[model samples]
Target: MWKKWMVCVLTLILSMPVVACEANPAPESQPAQQTLPYRIEVLADQLDVPWAMDIASDGRIFFTERPGRVRVIQSGKLLSEPLISFPAPFISEGEGGLLGLVLDPDFANNHYLYVYHTYKEGEVTFNRVLRLREANHAAQIDKVLLDKIPGSSIHNGGRIKIGLDQRLYITTGDAHEPIIAQDRASLAGKILRINLDGTIPADNPFSGSPVYSYGHRNPQGIAWHPDTGILYSSEHGQTAHDEINRIEPGANYGWPVISGEQQKEGMKSPLLQSGDTTWAPSGMTFVSKGPWKGQLLVANLRGKQLQKISLDATRPDTVLEAATLFQDEFGRLRDVVEGKDGILYLLTNNRDGRGNPREGDDKIIRLVPIQP
Candidate 1:
């Protein structure tokens, strides 16, 4: 009877169930296929080393050629006559020239245009910021906003942009003297914020100077977030460590002192870094309105392509995605700006001595968004 009971109990336990330790979850679904939503059109060709461009509120597109000429494209027609030209002593050497340009916030009434370029004083050469009056034929220099920032052949950071706060911001390279980037008294290797009249902003981080932030190394591209109003900058590292940083008041971006993967207290790290690859990023623009709205369109010279960086809506400084656009289709892109008409414009740097210039080298191309 006992043996029969044991057999029955064993059978009951065996028939209960077989339990495994853990069950495997199914694999996550693959991401959706990315479809680019823009078609390129040749807006203007034969441009010689176009560096930066901005569309005026009056729908006039003004651009700068590195050889010291400012050309206008009105009503989609490239004007045969040059709008303005810089005279002698404005040296176009190495990585320097008439680099950054911007129209005034009140340009319609004020008629002010600002530029950052390399200039010579006696035997000394330096970079400066000038505000000029745009007239019918030529522009007149109204004010020399800031001058005598240290300049070098290669590291003369000459990109400027107006922030949402209506302040003019400029980036300066270290003049190849990395030590100066850490000096608060010097403007080299720093991001400067100044008033429209080229005076120091009352609320600047520096008490009486225009030094907004310090410790930068050849920052070239700067733009403001349309939503969050934060400022972003792209800079070149020594050999590696191409970086994208969000600028803030009194912030000291780790440069000269440190590059990437190295952090210290009171020093800020970059948002994104290209570990060992050189993007050689130049001018960048934030798409204001279109299918690619809120995205940053950056021009890469060494990379010879366009990079579209998607910003996190909730955190504008956070980079959500980054992809190369028109890879090698246009050689050595230099600048990108969004037109008021919701079209994206790109400037090629093929004529910049280092690039492979095609037939109509260094052209201006527009990116037309595809409609669903």
Candidate 2:
């Protein structure tokens, strides 16, 4: 009788689904005997190509549409009208368009917002960082802080953020010109920093130049570590070796000089590399102040997944473990931002030329931990 009951129990258990707890499941040596804590929820849908986003002071989500609109999601709804729209001069070519967005540090008081986008002049098209003033539900164009960044149909690096130093940092691609990435004199293929008024900080690594670091192929993501205040970047690789780098002032990243397995003198090596695989990483952020606080969340474009990179106990230079989330479930992902309320907002890039879009395809999905 006891043996018959045990057999029935075992059959029931075998029919149950296995749940995962660890961000990355343990190796076969040690199994994962746990259940995942969080669940993903779609906050809004029926949107266009949502690229980058920033949490507004009032808890609203401000995001950019790759075409040329600055949109908002308020009270859990995708607002129909855009906060502001740019002219048709914006070239929505291959990779060029309205790309990144961020709010001023003192957005509550200043109501200023910034964007990184691609614009054309006669025949030449390039990227620029523009500041705008927000008031009464609308934003007005302000200073063109930085402009004329080298751009191309594909490799237009357009991630911008306000660093811990209270300065604007912008990343630019090689404009498809691999040679310029090694040129210190060119702003293309470099991370540039400037004051709010578009002036170069005197304390910059390069005294008079806005270049913070050089020798990059097509960097797409930049975020600061919460504990150490160190800057981290996500860069795209040619055939393989997508990288996450620890940014050091004036350091070279060895773009055309050395790609995948090669590293040279004076060029700082990346903290992590995905060999023979392309994450095609985009906007990234750290989950600061949550159960998964220190984990770095990256949105993968071509890989069509959300990846989590965990640091070691000492929080040193190396990644301890890595895992994927929503693998191909939502198509391509463009940005992942952690809101002040500890919720993670993931922007879907399904409407982009390369992705498979459904009716009302692109969306912003919110993730929250399911507490025990």
Candidate 3:
């Protein structure tokens, strides 16, 4: 009877479940990871080195191809024929060609468009800003707004935008001459502001001069903050120190003298820099809606990504965070613009002689933000 009772006790002890105690217990839950609010969709494909773009109030998209073609997309379709083609045989080697296109603020009434392109006169290379008139689905050169900007096979900074004040802003590179960036007299390496009629603003920082700000190496993009109207510029830095700067009138950005975080007494440092990383940032725009509103999106060429930059809410000049999206998904992004409907439009520059082209080569892509 004792042996049977011991066996029963052993069986009961063996049948009971065992629980081990952990030194540190995990929390009940973990925070979920956050994701981007938009997905990319291809709007048009097979484009040839599209450089810059702008959307019209009627939903028409006007863009410039590096090879002197101005194409249009209407009703969600890219037209087979270009709206107008700038006379070729111009200098398109490297970064020079037909670049920088923007529609007039009063385009609906005036049907005016502005463009910047490289040309040669008597063996001298130069860049000019021209106004075009569009009628009957065709455009012709209307007037030469500004001219005599130095151009080169590389470092021909060409990006144009009309500000809220109705003044035209143009970015010009140093034309491969680094020292000219500090010379206020040179049109190269400068941000120029002019009236719609191509006249220098009376309130310009320099009287009778179009130079708004100087000391830029190769500034390729410029955009104004949606709420503050503060202008920002994206510049290609020497030795992988790409910069995004808050532009002030007559301010010196210190191109060759200082880059990245190096500061000088009278020069304004960049709001954000890539440090050792090379973004080769091109066109940039501010988000107007959704979770990413007030942030800036920059298209990177060599980095082949769309860089999202957040700024401090209290300090508009301070950069809060920097992140990237769609890395290597598209080859060589050139421009990103916010559409009138609060969506984003992107351009791929694979065929620009520097990227590995995919099957479709170049494309126009759209990003629709996910609503809450």
Candidate 4:
């Protein structure tokens, strides 16, 4: 009877389910991959060395081809014909050609746009800013806002923007002459501020000169903080020490005398400097919305990336972090602009003679935010 009871108990225990445990638990099933904050979309492709671009309030994009054509993109399509082709031929040597474009603050009403380009004045290379008036989807040179800025095959600084004060701000390169950066009288290697009519403002740093700041090696980009109203500029260093400077009204940024954290008496050092790394930074803008809102995005050419900068919350001049994106994904980014819809647009420079062009060669890429 006892043996029969033991057999019955053993059978009951055997009928019960057997459970097993894993020592590693299969690594938690490998969590899902996180999505990126933004995705890239090719808005316009097959462009020819698009240098700079600006979006109008009406969602029209006006950009310049380095080969002297002012192209337009309207309603999600690139216009086959240029809005206005310059009657005068451009120098178009080395890095010289058409560059820098911006729309007027009152663009919707006045339909005015501005451009900077390299020109030849009796065999001497120079740069100038011209105002264009658009009517019936075509534009004409309305006025020459400023003229006779020193230009060269290289170092022809040509980024223009209207500041919060409604004044036109222009960046000029050293024209490969570093010494001229320290010369207060020279327009090259300096930031100039003028009225929309191209007149020097009464409150300029110098009593009668338009020189806002001097001692820039080759400032290719400038942007203002939306809330702080502080101005920032990106300059190409001698070779490696590319700089991002907080611009002041009369400050002398050390160029030839100092670079890459080298400080001198009465000279301002860069807020951020690339040590032994060449960014060739150009055409920056403060992001208005999305994941990068309130930060600064700069387009890099030689470094071939988009640099994102985060400023310190307490100290407006301090940079908390600087990160790079899309390294080598797009060959030689030239300009980055933030649209009214909070999207960022990038222009690739694959056909700039320095990069290996792919099938499309150059393209306009938009950073579309991934919605939650």
Which lDDT values do the candidates have, in the order given? 0.83, 0.83, 0.86, 0.85
lDDT of 4 by residue, 307-332 (tens): 88888656876676677778788989
Deviation (Å) of 362 in candidate 1: 0.7
lDDT by residue (1-372, candidate 2, tens digit) is: 865665574454335443322222221111222455667898988887988899877888899999899998888887888999988688789999999899998899998999999988889988999999988888889989988898999889999999989999998999999867866667899989999889999989988999999889999999888888889998999987787888999998878766555555566667777667778988899888667789888899998888787876465576777778777888899999888878888999888899899766788888887775
Report residue 282 deviation for candidate 3 (angstroms). Answer: 0.7
| Clash-forming residue pairs, model 4 | none
**What TM-score fits each model?**
0.89, 0.89, 0.89, 0.89
**In model 4, how large is the Cα lDDT of residue 158?**
92
Candidate 2 weakest lDDT stretch, 10 residues: 23-32
Clash tally for model 2: 1
Per-residue lDDT of 338 in model 4: 92
Give candidate 1 misplaced runs (Cα > 4 Å).
Answer: 1-33
* Better structure of 2 and 3 per lDDT: 3
Per-residue C-alpha lDDT of model 1 across residues 238-340, encoded as one tens digit per residue: 8877777888899988677667545645667777776667788888988998888888878888887788787787965567777777778898988888888
